[model samples]
Target: MKRIVPLLFLLVAAASLPAEKTAWAFRTGINLTPGLVYNRVWDPGYNGSALTVMSLRQNGGFILGGGIEAGYNYTGFNLHFPLRAGLTVAGGDSLTLSANLDLMPGLILGIPASYFLFALEASMEAVWQVSPCLGISLSAGPRYTVSPGYGEAVSPLEFIDLTVGLAAVMGN
Candidate 1:
């Protein structure tokens, strides 16, 4: 199941790419993500906090891309690799707007052995392309986490996150 999820996301992104013009670009950004955390079975003691991430992406006409992200919060740190896909939903030259979808798989560190977690996130982003080489974006989404419980059962946690970021873009 762990391998299947990422493979499925990659296949979907790749299958959609050939119909587009194939303009390629790369982006690096810093984001501030604030979220509300919840658990279905028990209390986690804390509800939420702000997280900071550094992300890098390589895209093709904003249609599809892959990225790596690393971040930290009050609880610990995490690393993610995600695949993105979407379209230019609105706007014009020198300033365009795009809507995007991302699927991320990640790991969390700094917790006890039984607390080792795996996270899968899905997000929607609104990007304002300021120029051919710059953009600003805001995104919101949900993240689901699964981990081993004290006695080896599965523990599940969920989060709703909102993020704002500024990026430097390169390529066509």
Candidate 2:
């Protein structure tokens, strides 16, 4: 009788413990993101006519395309760091093809919604992510022209970007 009682207690204790809701799952998905970039042009007045000084301005555009991301989730907190590289085709008179690279780290709080996962994303980018994949990304951040004369004359421009997009997961 004593042995049976001990076994029953163990079983009850195990059953009472809460199960883990989040696991280390592999994610590969695509996102269609539309965002803005603020850019500042610095011309040291070294290169003659090619060099021009400009003030900071707000540029608006859209980045339409896809990307692949991998991340992990534990409990209600998720750690996602995704590297997105794509193409950006500018709008209006500044019609130019630009290549962008963005390294994003995001965290989502609260219980994950069914069929839909939402989170607040904050990231720093060296280049626009959609410029390589999609056609265009607005001017919300500093952009260095890939051309030879442009990048060499002015270097290391600082830019802050605000991006909004949707991500879809594929496979397990």
Candidate 3:
């Protein structure tokens, strides 16, 4: 499953390349994501402060790409390598709005041991271009994860996350 995601992303990105001229830019983002986490069987907790480093791509005309994010959450940590695909829903000269979907197959290193966590998140971001190559973005999203509970039952974990991020973008 881990190996399949990257291969699938590459295939999609390659095949979806526009026949006409299109540009692709690499982005490195530093973000602070604060979220509210709720467990099905347990009580709700707000232990969701994370410092994330994400590397994503922005296609010039069509918004589609892949990304990997490594972050340190409150008591646990996660490495989310997802196919971060986005669509430019709205935009202006200084600001651009996008909606994104992330299909993440990642490692959830909870309290004791590491386990598999398949996560899905849908988000909307508004990017304010500080300069030609720099931007500040504000994003809010909801994430759902199918996680292993170790000794407890298997269920989905939910979170509503808000992020403030800065990005450095280059290329077409």
List clash counts for every candidate, in order: 0, 19, 0
What TM-score would each prediction reach against the true structure?
0.61, 0.22, 0.69
User: Residue 41, candidate 3: how far off, in angstroms?
Assistant: 5.7
**Per-residue lDDT tens digits of candidate 2, residues 1-172?**
3443454344334323333431111112223222232235532221101111111111223221212232222222322333333343443332444344443332332332211122223322222233333222232222211222222443332222233222221111
- Candidate 2 lDDT score at position 18: 38
Off by over 4 Å in 1: 1-20, 40-62, 110-131, 138-156
Task: Report the Cα RMSD per candidate.
Answer: 5.8, 21.6, 4.2
- Best prediction by lDDT: 3
Steric clash count of candidate 2: 19
Q: Per-residue alpha-carbon lDDT of model 3 for 22-79, expressed as tens digits?
A: 5555666665655554544444444444444344455553466565667665436776
**Ten contiguous residues minimizing lDDT sum, candidate 1:** 49-58
Find the number of clashing residue pairs for candidate 3: 0
- Alpha-carbon lDDT, every model: 0.53, 0.27, 0.61
